[model samples]
Target chain A: MFYFILDILGTIAFAISGVMVAMDKKLDVFGVFIVAFVTAVGGGTLRDVLIGQTPLFWLKDLTYIVTIIGAVIVAVVFRSRMSYFKRSLLLFDTLGIGLYTLVGVEKGLAVGLSPIMCVALGTITACFGGVTRDILCNEIPVIFRREIYATACILGGFGFFILRQLPLEETYSYATAILIIIVIRLLAVKFKLALPNIYKST
Target chain B: MFYFILDILGTIAFAISGVMVAMDKKLDVFGVFIVAFVTAVGGGTLRDVLIGQTPLFWLKDLTYIVTIIGAVIVAVVFRSRMSYFKRSLLLFDTLGIGLYTLVGVEKGLAVGLSPIMCVALGTITACFGGVTRDILCNEIPVIFRREIYATACILGGFGFFILRQLPLEETYSYATAILIIIVIRLLAVKFKLALPNIYKST
Candidate 1:
């Protein structure tokens, strides 16, 4: 139940972010909705697909669809006021990524993937939506370029595996994983930490 | 057996295209490989994921990987000669898309998707690799902006459905569908046909 609520919140947060990007790009209404939908569901969809989960998580449940629509509506309606709520939005986005990382890791474990693959899955699930959004918006993916976002997810994924090996209950391990992601992301942003650029100019 | 060969050829073609794009972007060797891999496999990966296939096609088979690597190696070695081979490359790419479109549609049908959904799947399979490659190269997807590429696939998908409805052998239908895609794409390129922009500036 808790995870379900978190998933919905994450969807809304991601959708809102997508809306902001689409607005920035001056996309038409259809384009805005497409971007918002892709941003909200793209990562999870990819994760589910990799795990051989058919029909996708969102397609099976209409609630996610409704939630994204609600988010887009709110974004369009409160466009002018969004800047004032930036901090809160960031918090929501952070929470979303943390929750998604854990969910993705759990799904990977359920599918009996290797530990490394599970961690990769978790990071992909937590970051690929933003990647898709940025790509659609015609920009380099922020996670790949500017921020320590995916790194945080990878750390959290490792934490999840490590915690699972301990004597603690499964729920505790999951909580620890989520907490690790949230803390790392928060610290990275607060400190303005970034990964080294791999691109070399000729 | 025929499809398998076609799939390998298509992978080589797409990977070559990816290498070309990466070279144009002045990406390093690792970057070039990454782009090549994504361009060769991205569309089929998306299709597989949507249909709930696990571990991905390339993950199961090393042949695809080797093919991509070979393509990248050849591209790097013959970088200066690529412009002269543009016409042949176009033909190969067109063949790749046609074959991929049929494969995607067949997979979707086998998984019991609606015909329209299968057609959509076919178009995605035929085009998304290039979309992913372009995005990774930090460019807007040519298909979405200025090409009749995806349109040819859609038309071919429709042709597949129509041909299947006939009393001819299944192989004939499949061959006809692929031919339709190739012919349409070749014509579109030759005539410089493009979709009108849907993005309207306010």
Candidate 2:
């Protein structure tokens, strides 16, 4: 139940972020809704599909969709004041990603995938929503070019496996993994760290 | 066996198209291969994932991967003379899309999805590979802004359903649908038809 609530919060944060970006791009109403919907659920949808989960996460439970729609509406209504809540949004997003990575790792383990593929799946679950949003908006995915966004998910995934090998309880290890992701992302942003760029400035 | 062969031919054509595009973008060899792999298998992957099919089409069968790698190598070897086979490539891509659409529709029908959703699955299977490729390369999807690419698939999808109502053999309807997509695409290209522009010029 606690995890479900957190997942809803994360979905709300993702949808709001999508709304903000779509509005910035001046998309039509349908476009804005589509963007928000995808941002909120795209990662989970991909994960579910990859694992052969039927009806999909969103399709199986309408709560995620409802939350996204509500979030989009609220964000759009409070667009001018959104800046004041930027920190809250960012924190939610970070928490959301952390939880998402854990969820993905768990699902991969359930499906008997290799550890490496599980990590990859975890990373995909936490980050690919934004990737799809960027693609739809006709921009390069920000994660591919900069920051520790995906790296945080990957590290969190590896940490989960490592923690599992320890004598600690499963719940404790899962909590630790989420914490690892949240802290890494927060610290990375605070320190302005980024992945190394391959292309030199022309 | 014939359908499987057609699928491979489609995969090879898609991979070659991806290789050409990645090469044009000056991506590294790894990047080129990734593009080729995704282009050849991405659509089917999405479809399979959505329907809760396990192992994925590529993962279940090595033939698809081997064919894509082979196609990439052949295209690269003949890179300079690729212009000579442009028409042939286009035909193969058209045929591939047609086959892909059919495959998607069949999968959806097998799973008992609604007709509209089945058509959606078909279109997604036929086109999203190119969409993924363009996004990775940092360009707007050409199908979204122009061309009858998706339209052809959609029309073909509806055609398939409509034809099912007729008192004819199943094979006849399937063949007609594929031919419809191919013919529509060819005619649309030859006449330079496109979806109307959405944005107003400043």
Candidate 3:
């Protein structure tokens, strides 16, 4: 039940971020909606596809559609106050990724994927939405260049696996995984931790 | 049988194009291979996912991986002479999209999607590889801003449906549809026919 709520919150958070980027790019309303929808679901969709899951999670459930629409409306109405809301938005976004990483890892394990593949899926789920959003908006994906986003997810996935081997309850292990992701992300942003540039510009 | 050969050729063309882009961006070897692989199979993978097909077309086949690797190696070895091969590459690419459009439309129809959705799938399959390629390379999708690329695929899709309704042989109708797409694309490039800008610059 908590996971379900966290999934919805993450979808809204991702959709809002997508809206912000689309608006910044001056996309048409249709384009904006498309971008937002892709941002909210792209990661999970990719993971589902990779695992041979059919119809996709969003297509099977209309709630995601409704939530994205609500997010779009909210973003449009509060466009003027977007800058001021950045910190709060970031908080939601962080929590969203935290929850999503655990969800993705669990799904991978359920499907009997290898441990490494499970971690990769978790990272992909947490980061690919923003990557798709930036691509549609015609920018380099911020996660590829910015502070430790996907890395935190990777670490959290590892943590989830490690904690699961302990004698603790599944819920506690999951919560610990989520917490590890959230704390890592918060620290990364707070301290400006980032991966080194892969390509050195001449 | 013919479709299989055309699909492989298309994969090679797209992979070569991806290698060119990655090299231009100065990405490392791993990045180059990744970009190439995505460019070759990204479109069909997306089409398959959307239509509830899974395991992805490329994953089930090893030929695609080998073809992309060969293309990448050739691209790197012949980097300095790429400009001279542009005409040949363009020819192969045109054929690739023509064949891919029909393949996508056929797949969609086979899955019992609506006619309009089938056409959309055709356009996506023919063009989205380049879109993914550009996105991974951190550029605006050339399709979104450029010439009549996707338009050709849409027109070809309609042509397929129209021809299917006639008394023509199945092979003839399919051939006609592919020919229409190739001719339209060739003419568009030759005459520089392009869609009007969505956003008029001040």
Across B87-168, the per-residue lDDT of candidate 2 in tens digits comes to 9998999999999999898889999998899999999999999988887879777788888999999999999999999999
Residue B105, candidate 3: Cα error in Å is 1.3
Judged by whole-model lDDT over C-alpha atoms, candidate 2 comes out at 0.85
Off by over 4 Å in 3: A1-53, A56-131, A139-202, B200-202
lDDT of each: 0.85, 0.85, 0.84
List the candidate 2 regions with Cα displacement exceeding 4 Å: A200-202, B1-37, B43-52, B57-131, B138-202
Q: Show model 1 residue runs off by greater than 4 Å.
A: A1-37, A43-52, A57-131, A139-202, B200-202
Candidate 3, residues B1-202, lDDT tens digits: the string is 7788888888888899899899989999999999999988888988887767767877898999999999999999989999999998998899999999988888877877666667767887988888889888887676655577888888989998988998989889889999999999999999998764422132
Best-fitting candidate, scored by DockQ:
1
A34-98: candidate 2 lDDT, tens digit per residue? 99999888998778777778778678787987888889889988999999999999999999999
DockQ of prediction 2: 0.16
Using all chains and alpha carbons, the TM-scores for the candidates as numbered come to 0.63, 0.62, 0.60
**Local accuracy of candidate 3 as per-residue lDDT tens digits, A1-202:** 7778888888999998988887777665545666788899899888887887875666546688789989988887777777788888888899999988877888899999888988998888888999988878777789888769999999998998899899999999889988999999999999988988876675
lDDT of 1 by residue, A142-175 (tens): 7877898999899999999999999999999998
> lDDT by residue for model 1 over B1-202, one digit each (tens)?
9888888888888999999899889999999999999999999988877777878888999999999999999989998999898898898899999999999899888877767668768987989899899888887666655677888888899998998898999999999999999999999899987754432222
Instruction: Indicate the docking level reached by candidate 1.
Output: incorrect
Count the clashes in each prediction.
Answer: 0, 0, 0
- How far does residue A94 in candidate 1 sit from its true spot (Å)? 16
